[model samples]
Target: MKRILLTGCAGFIGSNFVKTIASEQTDYEFDIIDALTYAGRKETIQEELNKHSFLQFHHLDIRDSSKIEKLFQERKYEGVIHFAAESHVDNSIKNPNIFVETNVLGTLNLLNASLKLFKENEAFRFVHVSTDEVYGQLTDDEPAFTEENQIKPSSPYSASKASSDLLVQSYYETFGLPTMITRCSNNYGPYQFPEKLIPVMIFKAQAKEKLPVYGDGKNIRDWIYVDDHNKGVWDVFLKGLAGEVYNLGGDSERRNIEVVNIILEHLGRSKELISYVTDRPGHDWRYAMDFSKARKELGWSPTVKFEEGIKKTIDWYLENKTWIEMVKGNNK
Candidate 1:
């Protein structure tokens, strides 16, 4: 069986990717590594691991270079899908140091290990997962960001991601390490951390609490289902040209208020719960992606529509109260 190393398998998108691949592809065996940070929960993936004998889990932080190097030396992985990082924007605003350390330095450690291993193992590939926030804000009339757009990140979180993206591409350029980068729009689905917008609104609205909206709630984003995003990532990892960047989007553009209202409707809540708050510092006004490259080149596009995906997500959270409660309790 092909051996693959997957980082951040206990986090939201990472966990989803693990489940998707385990069910869709039977030829690969996976070794998942996660630190179980506030956003990373083992329960998110415990059931999947129980079902798949080929899946293994390790509790380790990527920032620990010694431990990371030792693991890479021990295992001969044919590929790596890196997803571990400090992703919350609010937390990054409060503390940027961890973002830089984990996203930038941690990525460097992975690249160094890959460099050494790839020299010996010619089949090794590295896929660096990133966010569309690395391109900064866009106006209503502006065309959606493509891979060629200059990086102008607005927040420390995005800046760290941009730094990591650059580092990954640099490895391919300077060291000839086989690498690919993927920048994706907003993702929402099951197992998402409660701190994100959709889940936060779902949790608060269920409790009949005020759902806070930043600014006038006019900030726009392109939302992609986690499953679709993960599928696109896997496609790119398998078929994309080395050193290329692919953007994945849902093609569903909606304002923040619209998203909140949709969640309210799905949960049978009221608009009266909507509370407009001060906008965040360096908040991007809009984010959209032209994923034609991914669609045309990789034969990948989003399969889930927002309307259907959001309802499914709401239902998942409603049905799996224990999972959300565990995540909330651990975060506290």
Candidate 2:
């Protein structure tokens, strides 16, 4: 069986990807490494681990370079899907140090380890997952970001991610380490940490508590379903050219207010629960991605519509109340 190393497999997108791939593909085995951060939960991926003999979970932080290097030296991974990072923008703003350490330095450690391992296995591929926010904010009428867009990150989180992206590209350019980068739009789906917009709204609205809206609630984002994004990532990993970057998007653009209103309607809650709050420092006005390259090259397109995905997401949270509560409790 082909061995694949997946970091952050206990987190939202990583967990979803693990579950989906484990169910769909039987040829490859997975070695999942997660730090079990506030946003990551072992319970989220327990079912997949229990069901799939191909899946193994390791409680290891990517920031630990010695351990990371030792793992690469011990077992040769055919591919590496890197998803471990400090991802919250607000948390990054509060303390950018961890973001730099995890996203930048951690990525460097992985690249170094991969470089050593790649020498032994010539066909090794490294897939670095990133965000569209690395393109910085967009004007109301500005065109969506493409692979050609210059990196101009607006927040500490995006800055750290951008640094990592550049590092990955440099590895491919300098050492010819087979690497591909994928930048995806905002992702929303089941098992998402409740601090994000969709889940936060759902949690607060369910409790009849005030749903805080950052800024005037007019900020826009191109939201991709987490499953769709993960599928795109898998497509890029299998088919993409080395050193190339692919953007993945749902092609669904919606304003912050519109999303909140939709959740209220879904829960039969009042709009009075909506409360406008001060905008975050360096908040990006909008983020949209042009993923035609991924469609044309990888033959991949998002299958879920926003309305359908949103409802499904809401229903998931409603049904998985214990899961969400446990995650929230751990985060606290």
Candidate 3:
């Protein structure tokens, strides 16, 4: 049985990944470590807790180097799938130091522990989950960011993630650690924190409040379903070559205004609800990924279309009002 340690297992993407693996791999053992930070919630995994024997959860911060070291010493984890970080761009803008500390130092702590533990086992792989924002904005004329794109992160959050990616690469180059990195586009689906674009818009519309659209809402983002993004990460984790980077996108590019309009239409809300506000500092104009590598090598393709996925996501949030309420309560 493969014993895998998944960090940030309570956040949106991480939790989705855990659920997917739990359903698919009955014999696989998973040990989840999450700090239950403002973004991490136990309720994310509560549904499968009673049902999955192969899964275990631990409430711990990745920054606790000693605890991380101890866990590594005790557990025989075959692989480490890292997802923990301060991920929100707005929050990162408000407090960049936390982003640097968590995204860079936290990742380093995990890398250090993994390297030390896997010294005797060179075949162990480390999958670092990252974002396409590291590539910064793409010009209207420029094509999507491929794996070969140079790093040019603009926001503090993206910079921190880029820093972590560099550390991952250093581990691979300096120590020959088996590592793979996946940079994926914006993900939207169930259990997402309301601070994010899709959920925030949905909630504001439901409350009959102004849906804040940053700037003119012309910024473009390739929207990939959370589950599809998770599958792309797993594809890179299991079959990808060490020291390589892969880009994963749903190939569905939508302007921010377009997304807001779609949500409004789906919920039977009016476009007048959209309030165009000042854009955040250093907001990227666009982010699109060229995911041909993952598709060709791992045979992974996004199955859900943008319209269908967004509607399903809206329905989920509507049905699971308790979860949304609980998450909102935590921010207080």
Cα RMSDs of all predictions? 1.1, 1.1, 1.2
Candidate 1 displacement at residue 68 in angstroms: 0.7
Winner on TM-score (2 vs 3): 2
Task: Indicate the residue-level lDDT of 311 in model 1.
Answer: 95
Please, what are the lDDT tens digits per residue for candidate 3 over residues 1-332?
88889999888899888887655785678889999988889888977766787788888888889999899888878789999999999998889999988899999998998898679677689999999999999877789999999999999999999999999999999988899999999999998988999999999998889999999899999999999999988888889999999999988999999999988888899889999999999999999999988989899888889999999999999899988888878553
TM-score of each: 0.98, 0.98, 0.98
Ranking by lDDT: 2, 1, 3
Whole-model lDDT per candidate: 0.93, 0.93, 0.90
Clashes of 1: 0
Worst 10 residues of 3 by lDDT: 19-28
Model 1 worst lDDT run, 10 consecutive residues: 17-26
Task: Please identify which of the two predictions, 2 or 3, would achieve the higher lDDT against the true structure.
Answer: 2
Query: Could you tell me how far off, in angstroms, the CA of residue 104 lies in candidate 3 after the best superposition?
Result: 0.6
* Candidate 1 C-alpha lDDT tens digits along 58-149: 89999999999999989878899999999999999999999999999999999998888999988889999999999999999999999999
Clashing pairs in 3: none
